[model samples]
Target: MPEHSYLGLASAMHRLTELVIRAAMSELSFPSLSGRASCGLDAACGNGDHSIWLAQALLPEGQVTGLDICREGLLQARKASAKAGLADKLAYIQGDLHSLPFRDRAFDWAWCADCLWPGPKSQGFLGMDPMPVLEELVRVVRPGGLIAILFWSSQRLLPGHPYLEARLNATRAACYPFQEGGSFLDHILSAPVWLHQAGLEKIRGQTFVADLHTAVDGQAGDDLAACFQMLWGRAMPELSEADKAQFERLCHKSSPDFIANRPGYYGFITYTLFFGLVTSRPR
Candidate 1:
């Protein structure tokens, strides 16, 4: 992922899918989090997108701390939170996900987005064991508090090109968070089990979908283009010449047949969250 383009891409994605994100959050209940003193952590909160969401959700009282490994991202997050006038309720910090910077039971809850693990080693973040990272999340959250881990579970962007899309998805880049010899536990849906292993209780899962069925224009169109890149960015080596040509024809923003430009285009992606409660303090 290009550092220069992440903020814009992230911003566009947030704008495009905020409705579904909000809907997903609405279905979740954290009675304790609504209080004025409750403190929550937005783990790996990039550009403070979900951090702002958390802040708004805990409105009129609760405070949120946004933590990320990237300083640039935290800077952008600070700007964004301040712009939203949530600086009072939100704080930014630079820290590693593998070892959170806070103390034991520091927060009432933890909301982790697609940041629990790194992407392919060939990409920006060197892929590593996520168990330690998850343990850190559980460590900082208080007993009886909530811990939520979210993932970009699936995407259906290349309409009418299921085969190509399937192949693209099969590529190593698409199957993220996969270990070289990983088991089913490596899958995103296995998050509940992760929480269970980390000693969380009431393990459960839910998925939220962001669908683009209507007209997509201007920045949204470009953002959709960026989404295409992220989904199948590194599949060029795996795709045949013909497949590559077809991918460019349909996916590239400059192409006349770009999916976003076509009439009645439909694409949807899902964000799934697996949450559980800390039944007892970590020993």
Candidate 2:
């Protein structure tokens, strides 16, 4: 699992992605609640942003339970839920995604965002097999329920200044390797196959691009630059001193010599959401 402290930048990125997904979900005519109160499970719920959003969207009698392995994240999640006036509709628990603590058929639907990927321990450093996790989600969701998995596609650096682009490429190469001759995005794109093998029906996937570009003087630009800086700092152990310096210069939003001085200073990250229905459990 990623460290709890990583949520700051991650939360920022997630907020952007969630907005895109929320719009898509609305347009797709997602199912509406029936007679009984609707309930949902947010697996690996992080800071509970998604849980709260789910509750809001599924109202008037909807509730969401959020679970994560990171206690600190749940703490923040609880706080955010309270601040959003969604405390009554949202609940938080700390539990591993591999073996969820919920009972069979515990939720009407289950949601996992960026949590199905292999962790750091499995072969190729690609993480563990996601089958167990998917199975667990299947077990917890009632028949006819829905399961949604959202993840980021490989990042594409919009054509920026030459120096900045080179540094960004080097950073990406150092941080992410093409495991088994495929990039992380390739692995994510294969999730529908996993869902099928897990016995899910009505499996479907769609990609969304969140345009994160902003002018250097704007808050959005500063936030995105900060996220890049945080990522670079986390990868410092694997980065050369020269690379680190270059990243620092480029990510420094306030620096007069920053890369944003070049023409067309903007950034974007794409995300994809794959979802399926739990039609029935394997006998």
Candidate 3:
């Protein structure tokens, strides 16, 4: 990822997803994280928004260390922390999730987002097994500490307006190969099983739905539409000519025609969180 890349249109969609995750976090009951001067790790921290959130939430004397494989992401994360006046509370480092650079039991908790899916690709994809990475997270988090993973539960749009739903189906089909098991939903739904195999206990999961109605004409709605447009652009090579044209007709925000006729357009995406206690290291 590029420096300051997380501020772009595509990232806005990611931020929306995070918003849903934050709401879920607020509702879920977890052990008191604010009492002691505890430390936590934000694995695959990306631009570090979650790191900042973790630091603020775990504060008083608590700290959050953010680790990512992207150097530019870490740089941007550091800049963001400085901008937020959280440089002292948050630390950014560049490292691989499969082999974290921390000593055993370095953190009281570990949190990851959307980066654990297995796919065909190497650098970006999680490969055929995510156990190595989960084990690494467990290894660094102290026994009895919590591990949380938030990810998109499904790419398919839930039942909605027929036009928008069809477009979403096309979008998923175009992006099929890039996704794990031809669907991100499949991989995300299996998270509990993966966590269990990684030796985590007390596993729990939650799903949050974010609805974007373009007719509302808000910044968030516009941004969500733009994200779909971006996906369409990227998937153009895989899409048939007819599919491409239809996608553009429905999702292209830059089109003046689309701007003028924007009404009754709605989109829905779901995010899921899987959390548990790190009872022991992987056997």
Q: Cα deviation of 19 in candidate 1 (Å)?
A: 2.0
Give the least accurate 10-residue stretch of model 3, judged by summed lDDT.
1-10
What does candidate 1's lDDT look like per residue over 1-283, in tens digits? 3333466578777876787787666565544543445788998788888888877877467788998878988999999898999889999999887778899989998988776554444554425446787788888988888888887788898889999999888887667547456777666677777788888888989989998864744566777888888778777888889989988999999998887888878889898878888877535
Error of 1 at 62 (Å): 0.6
The candidate that wins on lDDT is 1
Top candidate on TM-score is 1
What stretches of model 2 exceed 4 Å from their correct place? Answer: 15-18, 24-37, 122-126, 162-186, 230-246, 259-265
Look at candidate 1 and give me any clashing residue pairs.
none
Off by over 4 Å in 3: 1-10, 27-37, 121-123, 155-186, 213-217, 234-242, 257-265, 280-283
Q: Measured by TM-score, how close is model 3 to the native structure?
A: 0.82
lDDT measured at residue 204 in model 1 versus the true structure, 0 to 100: 88
- Arranged by TM-score with the best first, the candidates are 1, 3, 2
* lDDT, each prediction: 0.79, 0.70, 0.70
When summed lDDT is taken over every stretch of 10 residues in candidate 1, the lowest stretch is 117-126
Alpha-carbon RMSD, candidate 1: 2.5
**How many clashes in each structure?**
0, 2, 0
Better of 1 and 2 by lDDT: 1
Query: What is the total number of backbone clashes in candidate 1?
Result: 0
Q: Is candidate 1 or candidate 3 better by lDDT?
A: 1
